[model samples]
Target: MTFPIRTPDDLHIEKRDLKFGRDDAPPRWWHSNDPGRTAFFNALSSTFPVGEKFFMTAVRHYRDGTAEPLRSQIDDFLYQESMHSREHVVFNRQAQDAGFDIASAEDRARRTIAWAKRRSPIQQLAGTCALEHFTATLAHDALANPEHLGGASNEARRMWQWHAIEEIEHKAVAFDTYLHATRTMTPFRRWLKRSVVMILTSLRFHYVIFRNTADLLRQDGRNDWATWKGLLAWLYGRKGLMRAMGLSIFTYIKPGFHPWEIDDRSLLKDALRLLEAGKPKEMAA
Candidate 1:
């Protein structure tokens, strides 16, 4: 299928108005207004800086003529990801203001960037594709598990939900670009490398979570039991986050799977219509 990449005409990235503890936003079940939530936010905050670097990397790759079709999407992708990183950074600041130490989280993120830089360009591209797939699965899970996320304030939920929808919307762009750039790679090798990257990256991410959670718990005078229980509960929740991730990964095995193919375009159309409608300011907000 020919993927005609189109950039949205009206993409804005204003700084969001979000307060940390004073906001009406309730924490996620895993966070439960606990110290763990702070840790989670801190970890998430680290993504923005990494995202900026990734954006530059995409631009560099695009300029080098690696993937012509995706060249059209590069500017849009950069805009979207830049905004995502900014909002997440704001969210992280809120968590820090609410008592989460974010220094270590930043350090971990820097280390991740350093590691990525060490890889060859093709390896880095493959890694990017794998990470994109991982994020797509996460976006789906976030939207599906409203119960877990429902406690967040209306505005916060809307922000996250919008982000999730867009993540799904652009899911295949990077993968398709990678395929086009690296056509010589055998399918078996591509799948194998993707699987390996997923396993390794997941482990690294979980390790950061574990460390951050432990730090938060210790600071709050909570024992290991509380931290372990929260983590376990999140993993074993009814929505089965891990299971969804595994299932989503299998989409790579399908020969012609693309994000646009799986996405509910009608929902996107409806959202666009709503966005275009002249609703009351508060109601839309």
Candidate 2:
């Protein structure tokens, strides 16, 4: 609703050291027992470890000169991201044990991160900002609309919902860091660089997710047209997660876009409540 809403002063982006799927392995088709849906989410999970590291690297490059509130937010962002990567590492292992080839998916993510590391710091931050927007929007959708993951097992659902909550909490850290890093650039140039990078980032992001999903599905022996059709429909059909997020995703390219302008904290609060409720009893205490 507004052009800017700083990360809530009272909202601490906590480093939740929670674990998921440590004791019980979710079924191979963890999301509604559907191979397409399962592979799609598994593909996304495969990228988190390396991808979050790159995000931290890019944001951390600009940390020194950042102002107070944002500096504190950056520290919290790094902590939350580290935890995300760690949990996803465990979740990816579960997918691997479920008979999918996670090594290749992780390798794909590593290669992308390696390539991104070669770019200038500001460019890399711009890329991080782009990807953060994508993640934040998807996270908001997943949390705001429960049916997106309604049928998933408790552990898997809680894992994803927890990730979504923190994502919404610190969604703007990368974008804010990018803006501060490029403060010297002309306004037009700043906009141009971020907008262009968002385009490039979207292309690469989609390619990796879809390609990895296809690769995983192939391992399940269902990479044919029929399987792809189901996957496509799951993502792009009516009531689809991606379809639901289309407009929110496009908001990133607006001239003066800020992640908080949409104000989805209500979703964050609800999801956080559910995640806390689902925690192990000892942890909850």
Candidate 3:
């Protein structure tokens, strides 16, 4: 099936400034009342503040060199990412309030991002591109499959829904920026670098997420086999989020991969309508 090719011209950044977890914290098991599932999302949220900063910096470094449309898209991407970071910071605080040591997880993410920053600019951009694709794939599933995040508290669910919507909207910005950054490099060399970096990034990203989830689970005295089993099942089982996105993830390393080639914007529109309905009139305007 041929998918319509989406470009930066189609990108629009919405500033929500939405807040959550301030008045009442979601229950410890916010997602489906499943401690394992809850910790998995909390672990992922804990990384966003620091990780998003890394992504913005990496993409912004190449903005001056990019031409029209893409240059403007990079600006939108940075702003949207900053908003994601802001909201996730609030969400992570709720995780901490729920008795999980989200600070430690954030610290680890900070250190990881710091290490990535020490690399060459292009390598950092390559890593950002890889990570962006990962989030975009996850975002696709989060919207397409209700069961993925079903049973979460309203605030938490909307928070993720908003985040997922924006993720899909600007999914291609970092990748296009990376391509522009490496415009002078040989195609083979560019592919090899992004491919290698993506492999490395994927390994470390999952390790950190799983490790953080385990740590959070331990805080709940859930170090038992069942907890671990459920967590694994949620991630890699037949209906696993990760398993479902395996093909989408692998497409990143294809010779001429571009995020919009997947054509999941129909999902984005439905998600946006849902999120917009919840927004205050002023903000929605």
Candidate 4:
């Protein structure tokens, strides 16, 4: 059954929880005290530049009228992504305050965004939908793993956990929007396009992670052997990061595949609590 697309009300950025970045507020994942885990998280943090660019590109695509239902999704997507960017910026600064060279890290992030922008719009959007699927799976795994983020401080873990929950929440919106917008494409062709995009984007993400990790290792005075080991461990751990990502990508080919279809609804209760606690005025349908 086709879900009726609804146009959400205009977003009020003013109503968002801006208190997230204040000085007295707790540090997010990027600034946690555990040196070993913090290094890992800082490396992971490098991925957000690409994430933000993807969402911004989606916002632009929807605003241009290429996707009908996505037009409404764009507002919430943009708002949430803007908040993500802001939080990460603050987190990056906190990392710098703790002695890392954030300026260099940010420079790399800017270069990556430029690369994403140079790709064709359709390619960019498809890559984003694939990444969204990857994140949806990662979010689920993260919520499941008892020690997934064991060393993080309470505030840091809370922030990342909150972000993960929301990522799962809207995971399918982009893919569904893309499907609706490109009505002429055959289902088989769409799946093929999605698979190709997923492979290419994963390679790009891996390249970024490799480069960023090398940079971090250089700054931290770590030997190449140790750094490489850490990278390998992250990918090959029991959770099988890349394998899970591939499985998530494959799920797109299944009939009725959607973010909510695989979701653990209990996690969503937390999101609902946050929404009600903030109580931002809801727009009339």
Candidate 1: regions farther than 4 A off: 1-34, 55-60, 63-69, 250-261, 264-285
> How do the residues 1-285 of candidate 3 rate in per-residue lDDT, one tens digit apiece?
122225645556555566765666898899999999899999999899999999999998888877777777888888889989998988987887777887678878888898899999999999998888888888888888878877888779889998988888888888878877777788899899999999999888988887888888889999789888878887887767777556555788899888888777678788888776766565569
Cα lDDT tens digits for candidate 4, 1-285: 234443222312122454243444444324334333466567666567556766667646746554444655666666767677777776666666666775565667677767777887766777777777777777777666636655565446656666666676666667766665555777677667777877787777667665666666677776367656765675566685555766665676565455556646665565446434442243212
List RMSD in Å for every model shown.
5.0, 2.5, 3.4, 5.9
Tell me how far the alpha carbon of residue 46 in candidate 2 is from the true structure, in angstroms, after superposition: 0.8
| TM-score on alpha carbons, each prediction | 0.76, 0.94, 0.92, 0.77
Candidate 3 lDDT trough over 10 residues, lowest sum = 1-10
Model 2, clash count?
Answer: 0
Model 4 spans with C-alpha error above 4 angstroms: 1-18, 24-36, 63-70, 227-231, 240-243, 253-257, 270-285
lDDT of 1 by residue, 161-233 (tens): 6666666666665766666655666767766665676567666666765576566666667647866677556
- Global lDDT scores for all candidate models: 0.58, 0.86, 0.83, 0.61
Tens digits of lDDT, candidate 2, 1-285? 112336666677877788888998999999998898999999999999999999998999889988888888999999999999999999999988887888888899999999999999889999999888888888887887788899899899999998888988999899888877777788799999999988888889888998899898988898889988987887887767777556555688888888888777677777888888888797789
Highest-scoring model, TM-score? 2
The CA lDDT at 74 in model 3 is 86
Task: Write down the lDDT that model 1 would get.
Answer: 0.58
* Clash tally, candidates in order: 0, 0, 0, 0
Model 4: per-residue Cα lDDT at residue 54: 68
The regions of model 3 sitting more than 4 angstroms off are 1-11, 277-285
- lDDT at 29 for candidate 1? 25
State model 4's lDDT. Answer: 0.61
